[model samples]
Target: MKGFKEFLLRGNVVELAVAVVIGAAFTNLVNTFVKGVINPIVGAFGTKDLASYTSCLKGPCETGPAGEVTSGVLILWGSVLSAALQFLITALVVYFVLIVPMNRMAARRKSLAEEAVEAEAKEVKLLTEIRDALVAPLR
Candidate 1:
């Protein structure tokens, strides 16, 4: 029980959980953009929704009253293409918006830490030399 609690509370685990939740939410935004904006432009070229684009493989494809597929062996390549575009957009946004900025911030932090350590070392060396000089005449 204690181990499980610790695991759940661990920083990496918590960060991962948050990331997953955020990613899921971000996916909805991406989907909305693609469906609302990109899809229409793409539709102007062909169908209104890329998901609606399909090719029959085995027999005549059948659609219900609402235009939903009832029976068919479809290639459904357009749906795949749409999904691939969504993935690409998500990747690009995450890379440019999150990853790139985070990396730059981390690098800045690392450089500052290194400078602090160096400053502390120099101060310590100076203090040690002062102590040596003060004690030299007495020795």
Candidate 2:
């Protein structure tokens, strides 16, 4: 029980849980965008809904009133295209908004840490020189 509590409180676990929740929400937002904005834009060329776009794999592919495949094989290329678009958009946004910024921040922190180390080394060297000079004169 104690270990379980500790595990739940661990930084990685908490971060992962938050990420899952946020990812789910983000997926919905991207889906909505694709359906509402992208589909309509593409609709200007053909159908308004991307999912409705299909290629008949077999002869005389038919759909029911609700668009369910009633007979024959159908390659739902439009749905695939829509999913691909959503994936691309999600990847682009995550890369630019999250990964890029985090990488920049990490680089900045590394540079600052290196600078501090260099400064400390210089200070130590200067102090050593001063101590050596004073001691040599006394000896």
Candidate 3:
């Protein structure tokens, strides 16, 4: 269908897919930073290591219900924390990289339009003055 084709080709859908992929990859990077870099350094003083900080009592992986979470230890809050941090970082990066630049481009275009309008107005004013001067002699 034409509508389906249009939807498939829409820029927003493509952009959103790209953003989701990038965000997923970035989250992995943030997890590495939190687990390898931040966790050990901070865990030295804390009660548990980053990996064990959020674990499941009876689950294969603590991030979520592994196969069948028998007990809900809820130590997996550490990964949640890492995810939240990643989200904040992603938002800031997107705002600065994409939104800010887009706004600036729009503002620049508006300024150029205003300048062109002003130039046109000046030209009209000069033409009117010349016409009045010529008519004055005739009067």
| Residue 122 CA displacement from its true place in model 2, Å | 0.8
lDDT of 2 by residue, 27-74 (tens): 999999998999999999999999888888768998899978899999
**CA RMSD per model (angstroms):** 3.4, 1.7, 5.5
* Distance from true location, Cα of 56 in model 1, Å: 3.6
Runs of candidate 1 with Cα error greater than 4 angstroms are 1-20, 58-72
List, residue by residue over 1-139, the lDDT tens digit for candidate 3.
Answer: 9999999899999999999998788778766766676667767888445444555554553333564445455556766765676677667777998999999999999999999999999999999999999999998
Best by lDDT: 2
Top TM-score hit:
2
- For model 3, state the Cα shift of residue 69 in Å: 4.9
**Cα displacement (Å) at residue 42, model 2:** 0.8
What's the lDDT for all of these models?
Answer: 0.93, 0.94, 0.75
Select the stronger candidate by lDDT from 1 and 3: 1
- Candidate 1 residue-wise lDDT at 39: 95
Per-prediction TM-score: 0.74, 0.90, 0.60
Which candidate, 2 or 3, would have the higher TM-score against the true structure?
2
Error of 1 at 2 (Å): 7.3
How would you encode candidate 1's per-residue C-alpha lDDT over 1-139 as one tens digit per residue? 9999999999999999999999889999999999999899998999979987778977888888997778877688889999999999999999999999999999999999999999999999999999999999999
lDDT of 1 at 103: 100
